[model samples]
Target: MQTDIEVYVLSCPTENIITWLEASFTLVKKSTSGPLCSKLTLLWQGNEVEVTILEQAAGKRFTSIWFDSDKTPWEDDITCAKQVFKALDCEVRCNFQGWEEEGNQDPDLWWRINHHGEGPFIWN
Candidate 1:
């Protein structure tokens, strides 16, 4: 099974997002076959797990993170997800399968999927 998540930014993104991400994790490989993207593997519970900046659009960015439902703690996985939000420093909508819907008080961290024509969504 594959676990995936997405973060969308409505405002223009800056280099700080990438800078912060690189600073937080280890980048193993960059994709040579598709759009400009990278492969990152992070150490969780003493094991290396694969994560990737699977998609990048003008205002929409998607991260592909994998977790074993039987073994990996959701807390650990979500902590990694929070890093993406921290790096962007802007309003972001997070979409990941399996979590119950709960409203947010902060506009900077939205959990629903709503997009305007301000920027590319990376994937169609």
Candidate 2:
């Protein structure tokens, strides 16, 4: 299982993200450092998870949600993306496979989930 989770969604509002977080986890604290970024501290399964939401992350239409902690519910970014897509009812994206600093991974390959379905695509 992954120690952290990070995924991107298309055009999701910050308020909606907070609402989903509040409903899914025990929110400890929330702070908006700027208009485009927000940080959330949450507790899940007796673990502290730090989540960061960054707007306009990809081409001004996508937002990044990064869960920095061990013991996150999902095993990898793709799994996490699926959950986010379902909860937020928006398009979500993640690397096609687990990322490694020195691994020979194709950067353009990505897993995407949306209202239509979920699949792998060459993200450009």
Candidate 3:
């Protein structure tokens, strides 16, 4: 048995660190690979959150998406998925481990998967 949950993708991310990233990031955006700076993994409570830059600075507009943590709620007006990131008071490092593991497993087994990629959901 495995416990799976709804995955959410946040749009138009407005993190305060955007200014730093914009000023310091120098890598050119690639069509497929994109820039390394544009990718990141936001982990909280052992759950995986994929945050990727969807668009570049368009006249001061910076946009990104947060996937896998913004949709679900674990407490009264508090989301368990985002709690860890907030507590750390920092940015998360980008890693493909979580996405690779989930992709290896059946795409539908999402519910059985944990943020740590430890899951193989058993079906009835």
Q: Candidates' lDDT values, in order? A: 0.43, 0.91, 0.34
- Model 2 agreement with the true structure over 7-86: per-residue lDDT tens digits: 99998998999999999999999999999999999999998899999999888999999999867889899988988988
Deviation in Å, model 3, residue 69 alpha carbon: 4.4
Order of the predicted models by lDDT, top scorer first: 2, 1, 3
TM-scores of all predicted structures: 0.44, 0.95, 0.27
Q: Model 1 Cα displacement at 101 (Å)?
A: 16
Which structure among the candidates has the greatest TM-score?
A: 2
lDDT of 2 at 93: 94
Residue 69, model 3: lDDT of: 47
Segments of candidate 2 deviating more than 4 angstroms: none
* Full-model lDDT, candidate 3: 0.34
Lowest summed lDDT across 10 adjacent residues in model 3 is found at: 1-10
